[model samples]
Target: MQGFEWHVPADQLHWKRLQKALPSLRDIGVDRMWIPPGCKGMDASGIGYDVYDLWDLGEFHQKGSRATRWGPKEHLSEMMQTAQDVGIGICWDTILNHKAGADRTETFQATKVNPEDRNAAISPPENISGWVRFDFSGRKGKYSSMKYHHQHFNGVDWNETRKETAIYKIAGARKDWAKDVSDEHGNYDYLMFANLDHTNPEVRADIFKWSEWIGTELPISGMRIDAAKHYSAAFQRDFVNHLRRTTFVGNHDTQPGQSLETIIIPFFKPIAYGLILLRSQGQPCVFYGDLYGLRGGPASLSRPACSGKLPILMQARKLYAYGEQRDYFDKRHCIGFVRYGTVHYSWGLACVISNTVATYKRMYVGVKHMGEEWTDILDWCIETVIIDHRGYGIFPVAAKSISVWVNDKAKGRKSLARPFDTDIYDL
Candidate 1:
């Protein structure tokens, strides 16, 4: 039954502005802020993914990340500190999946500089820590299908075929990192992405080192495990276990394999963690990406074909996961669920209303079933916490000039549905 959600720029911003808005946001029922990892630009076509300097944010980005001008992580930390003082919980984006090439370009200047030393942290073969591609077919059991292609060059399942040549290209193995794993037809010996191999002990070590540093130093109150769907469910448990045990006291597991192998890694349920932790000492807010409906009934917000999963991992959410406050199907904007303490009310008797792209379509269908072209405001108040703004006021468009009314109430909140204002529940 918590209220609104806000996504703050993880980059630098006027701390004073955020400070000033704190009281207002609090008044508006925004309990948490999911901060971004970086402020880098990302073009949908070229970028199945985007890059950011995780450790080195010398300054803050002024514009949209998909738009440029990234800042230092310190700036974000400062804002987070302020948020804590204001009784707002902070959720930091855990961008552990991949990193930008810029940071690894110099490779290993921090280590002893020796041209012949291949073991250097920044060696040609060691482009980045934990970002190495896998040769699962050779030394270990790996599944290329597991990598999240949205961050890759082509954004498809190359791992299923396991073409060594294709693997080389995806790993960005150019001048020095190249190997003789390819054949004449340009097929891969093993298909894989530039993802960090969890099986590699050294890779695991680096991940922990960084995790401890950020968790302890930055006062990271919460986490949003990025690309959760791609990683092994068991590995997710191990990662979180390590995350939970973070003492912030020099945690670096150098033993390349089996730090805590006995424990069976649980399914990578990011939201499930929230379900458990929110009731316990762990942070309460975690986002579930449209997979709810597929598992339960209907109430997801993604296109199955869009993600390329064999079967759609999305749903057409009709009911929310709330306990007795359920809105009669047609009265709700969109359904959002929570597995709060001891409750699995999938019937969605409770609701939260917001004007989001994901919810509107489902809401529209519900509205159509109820014989209405649009919805009212009070209905939204019961369903989602309405926000008047969006990223600098620009709405998320289906295409150019096809605006979405995610943030219509805010004076400056932008909408992608420009030139043709669609009905966006103006109650």
Candidate 2:
């Protein structure tokens, strides 16, 4: 597991070290690995959001070094190949909404906009704009010559002359804010640093061009789009459609109760994982924090502490829990689904999870599974359930517990065969 501000080596070096673990990760049924941002951040120590140069990915002697925090270009390539060899796909974290660490600043005319209501300009356009501009003298326009001017951005947070951090919209622009963005702050087009103007034809074209270049250059399976709500959703859709690869959505780590940690704590992680990994819907992403139980650090928020039960859960998902899915979301305080196996797959499972204490549900999976016995692979509940002749059965779970019952005849038995048992009654 990698912390947001963990003491990691350069990107290349980190990848080199990570390559050794690919086989182990693959053995655990981790099909995809969503790594951090590939491109160089504003600084080598950055997490790759404050993008200084899009073209410079730890190659040139920029940001006071020749490599990003992950490592150099060569190491990254080797890491990708190593993981791919083990059948693990790499998803690049793409940050296209904003950029920081500009080489210089430019002065222009702009208007101050309300932070809560970005659509309403507080003051008229005046010659009082000062924001970072990118010329990339260190890169010397190697792979791309797309220099960033103030006009390329919709708004910026900081003003150099006044030394104040306020939302200022660029002058001479037709629209005060980008269209069709999340209504969080009235208009969430501008997040931080220089917000990329997606409406600008050149800006849009340049980003697409960079995407194409990076996609061809690196052996990646897809991208993890950052700050999607801050940009045009249509543009994001177009970019993702063009890539024709897997794409996922997420953002920077936030405080607890506002993140997946809400359901990833010691009490409910198994239930949360069961709901995601066992289902036949969106591709489930296993966070490193959850996999290894990384906790709160000085820079990062407190991650949910967990027992080392993720591997067993992952194993269950791999060997069994395949085929068609049937949702049973009509129950109160409990929701579950059944994975019906096909001719080639027969270890289908029924996953039942509940947030309420001491819950039971009499649900129907299918008529075909009548008279079959099921065992809880979680080992938390020692009881077993049998499908009735009517294809309906009552499943019981202790307070705030998850039950993943697999067919007893199935070959998958790692979780079931484990020596330890968590008595739900004790919990």
Top candidate when judged by TM-score against the true structure: 2
Off by over 4 Å in 1: 1-20, 39-49, 59-70, 102-166, 169-193, 247-427
TM-scores of the candidates are 0.38, 0.82
Q: Distance (Å) between predicted and true CA of 76, model 2? A: 1.6
Which run of 10 residues does model 2 get worst, by summed lDDT? 418-427
Stretches off by above 4 angstroms in model 2 are: 1-13, 173-175, 241-265, 295-306, 326-337, 354-374, 383-396, 407-409, 415-427
Per-residue lDDT over 1-427 for candidate 2, one digit per residue giving the tens place of the 0 to 100 score: 2222232334346665567666766665778787888687787877687887778777888878888887788888888888778888887878999888888889988889989988888988876646558888888888888888987887888788888888998887474576789988888888988888888887888888888888778877767788888898888888877666433222226324334323334677677777777788776767665554333343332332335566667777787768888888897888878788778887677777888877777777677879988777776678888999998878777778888787677785744455322211121
Query: Deviation in angstroms for 409 in model 2?
Result: 5.2
**Candidate 2, pairs of clashing residues:** 10-69, 10-70, 10-71, 11-69, 11-70, 11-71, 12-70, 12-71, 357-399, 358-399
Weakest 10 consecutive residues of candidate 1 by summed lDDT: 310-319
Candidate 2, after superposition: displacement of residue 423 in Å?
A: 27
lDDT over C-alpha atoms for residue 386 of model 1 = 29
